[model samples]
Target: MKDADFSDLLLIRKGEKDLTLGGGDSALAPVVSIGEWEARKEALKELYMLTLGQAPYHDIDPDLEIISEEDCGAYLRRKLMYNTGADERISAYMLLPKGLKGKVPAVLCIHPTTSMGKEQTIGNDPSSNGHDRAYALHLVEQGFITFAFDLMSAGERCFSGLKDFDTAPFYEKYPKWSSRGKDLWDVSQALDVVQSMPEVDAEKIGSIGHSQGGGITIHAMAVEPRIKAGVSSCGEWPMRISKNPFNAARTGWWVGRPLLRPFCVTGKEFPVQMHELLAMAAPNAIMNISALNDCKYTVEEKEFTGEAFRNMEENARKIYQLYGRPEAFKSITHLNGHSFLKEQRKAAYEFLKQHLFK
Candidate 1:
């Protein structure tokens, strides 16, 4: 679709019901009935794809390659690489539980914004400090086949002598595409890798992440129906409320896109809101784990406060209620500031298990 066509969908219309009511103040489109929601869902998906730059077709075979393998007692850990694009490969680590009786549920464990990338999720990088970030390892011990991979510009994908979070090289390679798109595309590809495994129950795949990874989990769950359930930790924030919505200047590129840059510069409202994005995953199981003190510094400034996060969850719950599966949508908050503590990790695993395992 043309940039103008996509931008037009984002324009707020008159005479629509307001879902945000007293929530974090933002212009959101009204939620319609189930039949209308089905059509609107597809439209919203298209708009999001346009905003992130449509991902190229992945027609090539994912020629999977195993670099090395080691036995870690309860599970076998393998360092592997697979094709995302015909010319592009993603480095990953897969933990397969030993002596599986049959096909079991699998989880795509996305790591936070650390230089260690997938290594942190598997507890292989001690220098990357955090509490129980080795969630991939923990899940594997719980008998779930877990796959963790390096996002673009992270882990082994990082350029020589550069940090993992750098996006300059990525933009240089694909100036029109946003880092967010690449991340989400890679995740869909990772799902391909995990689903192909003999020990994995392809129908029971889920995703979990914290911070940047958390944000990716949310987007991935929205677009990829293969993700039966997901846990997004401390990644709830409205793009319009961002100081530089849609990364207008291309600095700190996360959710910014070229098509939305004009709106950012003009200070105009985007057609969709964060709550609406979360709502797009209705009838499917998804949980938002927000920290009460998340973005503490900014909350002190009255920007993206915890109240806003709860408001987004509340508004999104309306869609779940419409689907008659309100229990499938859940959220929990803690006093910890931005960090995913051990207790939160436990809760996340339980939620995923409840949804994906049974």
Candidate 2:
């Protein structure tokens, strides 16, 4: 009846119409058995690939040149550079235990969005303080070989000399390219590097990451089967984007901007719901760590985020159960804000150890 009430009505109507255009069709169709789950997973995987756009080309035979090597007591760190595509050269650090005779389990330690990037994860950066504790070094201490690589626009790849990464330039230069696709391809190729190592047990390779690093861990698991196990700490939750545009834009960067509907016409709903992505990772061991009072999302928002993750876990577990390995999917939540704290870190390590080593 009043002006405020009329405005609310308009907002609600707009939201409803947008949802319809985004294909409000739910991804949570009932699955009766493993065969049905398998078909669903295949369909979801195909849709996800389409949503992410095309990934760059890969050349796995590039000569990985080790430019420097250092002995870090528990492990040997070798800094290496190689080409992932025709023009995409990657710089990464490989940590190998001192006396690993046979092939050992390996982890692709993805780095968070930091200026130091891979150095922070590999324990070579002193400026990170306590926030960016070297988790990759910890993995090496736990007797697993590890590889930490710089994501695009981070570490050495931030070649623009700008203070912050601006993906707008990239999109302008290559209109059809997807940032998420390029990143997915890059990390997938990193798996190739892990498998190529003589000391790495390729079949037992896993990945762990914090924040954006954690977000990629989930994405990598859904798309990259080479990752046998994965741990995502305070990463992006599947259903957060459509509802929370602010957080999505804050975390997603330029390319992620379009995911907020009405902002970009093409950025409607994903062909499959976020839960389906988890389902796509079926049979593989995956662990999601959530923080109850994360600073990123408000208290009310966290409640929704937590519920979304729980729902995803529930639906994804159906697929895992169909495989007769329900324990493959696990989730943990703590009161601490967004972080991969000591207790959380330990749980991730034990998870990987259990699945990949035990």
Candidate 3:
């Protein structure tokens, strides 16, 4: 039998900076994957092209269904949201068809922009101009089901005055030990819910997220097999070793917070890129949306970011194409910046309709 270890299968070659992909100085630029490279290096080249990364790390913890709330007339509420125990009790919202009697399609909604603590704060911002509720509600209206809720630190469990928490419990329990493991927890727990439901077609479940949620979506898909498709917004900054967005490699998502030096990450254990995370969705359709004028970063940098994410998009297609379906992945651009656009939404629904409903 062939040894499982791929050590002899490939090596990580370090090329000069000037020999970078496309010879572009911008981290977002793409490079041709010279087939002669080693396995990880080839994977890295493919990952760099897509602009997303593989999982930061994979956990061995088994999936467990630990929470279920029956209060919503909306989604079937549950918490196997976080597949791994890295995060905890990540509250999830499952919106099903109003008059549904049986199985239906479902989408796991992820929130990209988040704060220090309190995972549920994402739900309230629906009143904001770019809030995701409109899309979630729109999904409901389209005879589809969606689950949208606060991630670790945004909505009800908020850290810096964000979520809709019941402070009475805080006063009753004293020190609340959260903030650290809430995000990943919700994702795994939600995964359990998706897999266990008879009304949900396990093969058709998908995910869509913006900002911090988008980043989480990338992470979730990297580790979960149920996610059939993903639409990522501005959280496409993981691959760039520069400033702004989720490129924690530079300034970290929490501005002013200490930046993460590669060496400082648990004795140099490398985290996967966002593109690699996207690749975990192989054989599934993915739509990456970005705008050239996003104000989050400087103008020139935005273009570079776009090119980099496109590399990820194309690479994902290449992999899925190996499964013999080149149309399983895609990328789109808007003239605007940072925010998810209507066109992207339209395209997303269409992709879902094609892959899931068809």
TM-score of 1: 0.85
Q: Which 10-residue span in candidate 1 carries the lowest summed lDDT? A: 1-10
Best by lDDT: 1
Cα shift from native, residue 230, model 2 (Å): 0.5
Q: Of the pair 2 and 3, which is ahead by lDDT?
A: 2
Question: Which model is ahead, 1 or 2, in terms of TM-score?
Answer: 1
**Can you give the lDDT of residue 72 in candidate 3?**
45
Error of 3 at 151 (Å): 1.1
Name the best candidate (by TM-score): 1
Per-residue accuracy of model 2 over 1-358 as CA lDDT, tens digit each: 1111111100111223355477544343355666655665676677677666554454556567889988988889999888876666788999988988899899999887677888888777676243445889999999999899887777887758554344665566555656667678788778877798888888999999998788788888897888999988877654433444444343334454333444334455445544555556768999988775664456656565566556556656767887888999888877678777789899999999999997
Q: Candidate 1 on 95-169: residue-level lDDT in tens?
A: 999999999999999998888888899988666354468889989999899999988878888866766677877
lDDT of 3 by residue, 216-277 (tens): 66655655566777777665553333333323433322321122344344444224445565
TM-score to native of every candidate shown: 0.85, 0.84, 0.64
Per-candidate local distance difference test: 0.76, 0.72, 0.53
Model 1 lDDT, residue 90, Cα: 73
**Candidate 3 positional error at 80, Å:** 12
Candidates sorted on TM-score, descending:
1, 2, 3
